[model samples]
Target: MEANYVSKTAKSMQLHRRAKQVLPAGVSYFIRYFKPYPFYVDWAKGSKIRDVDGNVYTDYWMGHYTHILGHSPSRIVKAVKEQIEHGTHYGVCHELEIALAEQVVKMVPSAEMVRFSNSGTEAAMYATRLARSYTGKNKIVKFEGGWHGGYDALHLAVKPPFELLESNGITDGALRDTIVAPFNNLQETKKRINDKEIAAVIVEPVIGAGGCIPAEKEFLKGLRELCHEKDAVLIFDEIITGFRLAPGGGQQYYGVIPDITILGKILGGGFPIGGVTGRRDIMERMDPLLYERPKFSFQGGTFTANPATLTAGLEMLRNLEDGRVINNLNRHGRRVYRGLEAVFERKKVDAVVNCVGSLFQVHFTREKVRDVNAAYRADKEKLAKYHSALMDNSVFFLPAKNGAISSAHSEEDLEKLILETERFVGESGY
Candidate 1:
């Protein structure tokens, strides 16, 4: 498999060698790196990405699942092009920013106010600080498998061996107040959260980086009650599930509202952006006019609300506001989930498919993958091989990463995915 991939991606191999000389890990993000090097994309359109080697693959990765309407959708491209002519980055406020914020407030169930940032990590960091400021409590409760970016405060125990640090530089003081709780298991989570003065309970409605596992509706409801009982804020990290799940995001999809929503990915409309939004009272903690020093939770940057990002994001939201596009994606998600599961079962492959809305992942394990531990226990090596096989067959899914369905994906694209999986299963003797 490695040799076959290498033969097809000669140009990418050359670029990887060049990239390794400058960029750490030969990539901007470590997660983008894969065995035998990764392909360098020349361009992408609709649901296909063409590598520099001219190999066109049906893309399920979809720019880290950011392109809900598909790569360079005409609407966003047109809006961004016009906005770029005016100004790309304005180190000041603009109507586009206000428009985007208002759109967020109108769409998100709990968003009465919004603040933009550059990425999900920054949004998570800001949300943590704002939670601490609002409640005057230092402790935070996060699920065991929840991945809220690389923020130090909530970064621990994202994978298996849940007691270890996720990275090297994180200090004891940084994670001292962060508590790890079990996902999907409310009783265990409560035991973990017992008597702690939690400022916020942060969770991803559908776990992304940890696995494509979704929180049970009852579990989310339980967390909502728990947070309210403790007078702690309930934060939903809807970065992956934002507009992809519904116009109002996971909060609206699950019918359980949260105090804060951390958004990114599709919210940027394929541009670089992140956002924090919530009820007026909780969100106002970041307002300098409403709160004095020591109380204000600061959140600003040189590109906090860049005009270009806002323009693309605003246009994206306007298209999704009617719910037609989102509902179609959700329908596609269900079809893919059922189709993949049926294919695996027919092949007698002991695999589990985890899915929520437009996101899905295949675990090479017979056991149920309800949480991160189960996901980690799966045959990761086999899963990687399967993904590589799919890629070699011109269906791209980042190895061991969740696959996302976009509006651009057609019935044929989905059929090809299922067929490829079936082929991999039969050939691999799994």
Candidate 2:
């Protein structure tokens, strides 16, 4: 198996070597890099991807969970094609922006008003700023492993060893105002927020990049109550959870509506997009008509409402209105979750698979993974080996990242993944 992978992927290996000279770590995204090297994709369609070496695999990464409808779904492709023919960038107001925004407002419970940005990172940064402007507060409270974006203010404590900065070049001042709290621990979180002038408390309903550990229902409810008491804005960073869990995202699933919600990933119909949505009064702070107002929070981008992205997003949302697609994908995800549990039980492997909606992760531990600290306690080396083994068997899932199921996935795809997982466990001596 190893020899075949190496022989078939010779071209990909050559490309990786060439890419090293130009791209950092031979990959554009840091997470895309792995031990041997990341596969160079030639093309992808539906639920499968083909590498440069003509090696095809069932893809679960699904464009970093952005391709909820799967790679180049016919509807999105047609919409983008028609939109580009008209014009790629208008740099002015277009009807498509209103179309998408209206759809968001109708779907998401708290999205009375909407603002679009280019990426989740940008949207999150703006959400934080808006919170500060609304409450006249300076500090922000975020969960220990909650990953909002790459921005300086909300970038700390995404992973363990919470005392240190997650990345270098972050100034001391940037860290001063950001408070990190223990996820799923109400007492600890309340203590951290006590006496602090918190403008916003941003949290992921399910920790996406950190791990697939879900926030407990009681915990989320407690945070909502705390925010109301403290006069702080509750920001739900639903970049991964939005539209995937349900049409209304995590707030709908948990029945806890936040003051602000940051949405991205699946919302763009396989394009780069992010959105900040909330109450009308709060979002109106960015209204250009309020330019003379001292409380106005400036929010604009070069491609804020580009017609192409909005058109694609609108089409995607239109297709999702029936809710059948999301239901099917989630059903498959539950099947995968059960299959994983069965595999561990059969193989007598001490592992836990955390699953929520259409997302799942394999953690090599017997302990329940409720937070980042518990997730980190898993056997890292064994988990890495399991990921590698799955890849060798022509199944693609990002190492240490959650796997997303799409509506494009078929029963055969699920069966193959289960079989491959069984093989991996049996052969890995776990």
Candidate 3:
């Protein structure tokens, strides 16, 4: 048998065939591989997804850390459905927009005002512009593994193994204007500073895609102090962490506030939305009335602040009133983390896990994945084997180590993940 996933889904094969002929890389995203081909998803619901072949799985990818309250949550879905009935897009202001903005201000301690966009990239693109415009400076400093939504500057040296400096256009001067220091390297980050030319230091607080590594409290606090001392803005790109870590996201958890925060993912409850919000004075520039003309910031998209997204966002924000989502997520996350950790430890396997709040990553190294260097040092080959086996055993991850958590998952899901992982490690000869 060539795996149930491959043997079934005849229509999927045809669809992929047609898709590859027209679509770049056979899909819009690089992760949607068509070489070995990819499985098609029919639809999904709370805690479970059914692929084209009806392989029901307790999905943990959660739309790449986007679905905090779970897939098509009733509150979110109801909001969307009602809004959908009212002609999807309104290229103008709406009440939902105001509600969403107000909700963000109330929840995120750092955000006094929020301007919406359709994606985190846009939020980050504008955050960069705002940092430059506010400070009258041009340089942007980012951590080694911090991914701030894939514009030219922040995308550099993103996923390369720690030992290698693999990047493009991030030259010495490029890097000089855009400082790239190893995460958690307080001295290196300190050395990159001087007489206030660095416009901002942008980070994820807990770097999500970079193997779920959380900054040491000292490292984050140091960045805060250094940015303040250097007259630079400290920006937290909480696109993934916002509403996922806690009601206030990483800012509340870490207790180190940033000057500006870029948000996405959970804010829209799995819809395509993003926002950049901060101090009122800085955000007022986006107000057309202030300048007698509407000017575009990096976060501005034509679809930004439209009715449908605002509805979904407003509902999602409202759902956080109970604080139960974060609590459930953290509980499930801890269970999974501990279950996996115990398996590795009891078996004395050469593996490690990085966990914080409700997010985690299982690295196949005993060295501890504190930073990108250690994450790169982990046994990726074993991880691949483990990932494949877990899939075979009917659990779902991102098919990559860096993934998310959700309130929808249960301990049963964790057991499935752990048992499959242990079985793979013991049997796969790693």
Per-residue lDDT over 225-278 for candidate 1, one digit per residue giving the tens place of the 0 to 100 score? 999999999999999999888899989999999999999998998999999999
The TM-score leader among the candidates is 1
Residue 175 error, candidate 1, Å: 0.7
Quantify all predictions' global Cα lDDT against the true fold.
0.92, 0.89, 0.78
Question: Model 3: per-residue lDDT, tens digit, 1-430?
Answer: 1255576656677778888899976787765462246667898887788777777777777887777766778777887898899979978767888888889999999989988888998888888888877776888888887788766666665776533554545455544477777788889777765453788999888988779999888898998998888888999999988887889989988999999999998887788988999988777766666633324343466788878778888888888756787878888888878888888887888888888877888898878677877787787766666666676677777656565677667667777778887787678655
| lDDT at position 118, candidate 1 | 98
Each prediction's RMSD over C-alphas, in Å, is 0.9, 1.2, 2.6
Question: Can you rank all candidates by lDDT, best first?
Answer: 1, 2, 3
Q: Count the backbone clashes (under 3 Å) in each candidate.
A: 0, 0, 0
Which segments of model 2 are wrong by more than 4 Å? 1-4, 291-293
TM-score of every candidate: 0.99, 0.98, 0.93
| Clash pairs, model 3 backbone | none
- Give the range where candidate 2 is weakest over 10 consecutive residues by summed lDDT: 1-10
